[model samples]
Target: MKIDFEKIAEEHIEGFKGGEGRLDTRNYVDDRARIMYSTLRPGPKSGKHPHAGSFEVMYVVSGELTVHYDGSEEIIKMGQVHYCPNGHQHWFENKTDHDVIYFAVVPTLG
Candidate 1:
């Protein structure tokens, strides 16, 4: 079957916000691969958190976010992709005027 990405976005990812930890799964194939999107409010932080199994890949679709990772920080802007490897803890904040939006592939426990 074919997929309609636009309709999927409206149905799965619309009205998402940060600080609320909204993670909507658009599509999942084989239970191992998935697509998800998130939206963040201005000046919103993800709080101090750690990934027990860190193997996440993300792409910033719009706005900007400062990621606090491994004792340092980096500003991830639009059209940029970032990877969070294993054992690395990170938190992110929206440091821009507009809302921050991003998509990622996260591996979940079976």
Candidate 2:
């Protein structure tokens, strides 16, 4: 099946998990997964939080992002992907001057 994000997704500004600044997100949710096309301005971050019942994968669509997980951090540039497994904590920070664009896929566990 195909999902058309532009036609069906809802956009919102949210400060998820205590992150700094607001995040612009176009999201699609279902019983199996939550898919998001997200953007963040430079210096803002998605706050750290544990994935208690889901695993999340983020694919960088533009600019750069730093993924922080389990006490370590990695820079994910355009075209890169980062994964946060269930039961672990993670966050994303945009350190560049440009807006960071990414797609996040979070699948339900069990």
Candidate 3:
């Protein structure tokens, strides 16, 4: 199956997961998975949260992102991918002046 992101409506989320600033995204979500094309504005971040029953995979498309995973920090630049396995906690931060664009997928587990 193919997904055309250009047709999807973008949503702006403020303080996503209890973090600062905003996140702009176009999403495709269902019971099986959550897929999104997103942009993180400078100074905004995704709050640290546990994966719980699912795992997330994020691919950086442009710019860079700082990830705090399980008490450590990681820098994910363009062409890099970051994965957060189930039961782990992680968050993303955009600290540069440019926007950070990425694609992400979160799959639900049985």
Best by lDDT: 3
What TM-score would each prediction reach against the true structure?
Answer: 0.68, 0.92, 0.98
Task: Answer with 1 or 2, whichever has the higher TM-score.
Answer: 2
In Å, residue 57's CA in model 2 sits off its true spot by 0.5
Q: Which of 1 and 3 is ahead in lDDT?
A: 3
Q: lDDT score, residue 97, model 1?
A: 75
State the lDDT of candidate 3 residue by residue for 1-110, as single tens digits.
Answer: 79899999999999999999999999999889999999998899988899999999999999999999999999999999999999999999998999999999999899
Name the candidate that leads on TM-score: 3
* Residue pairs in candidate 3 whose N, alpha carbon or C atoms collide under 3 angstroms: none
Error of 3 at 61 (Å): 0.3
Model 2 alpha-carbon miss at residue 50, Å? 0.5
How do the candidates rank by TM-score, highest first? 3, 2, 1
What is candidate 2's lDDT per residue for 39-90, written digit by digit as tens?
8888888888999999999999999999899999899999999999889999
Per-residue lDDT for 36-60 in model 1, tens only?
Answer: 6666767557655566554667789
Q: Which stretches of candidate 2 lie over 4 Å from their true place?
A: none
Give lDDT per model, in order: 0.66, 0.88, 0.95
Off by over 4 Å in 3: none
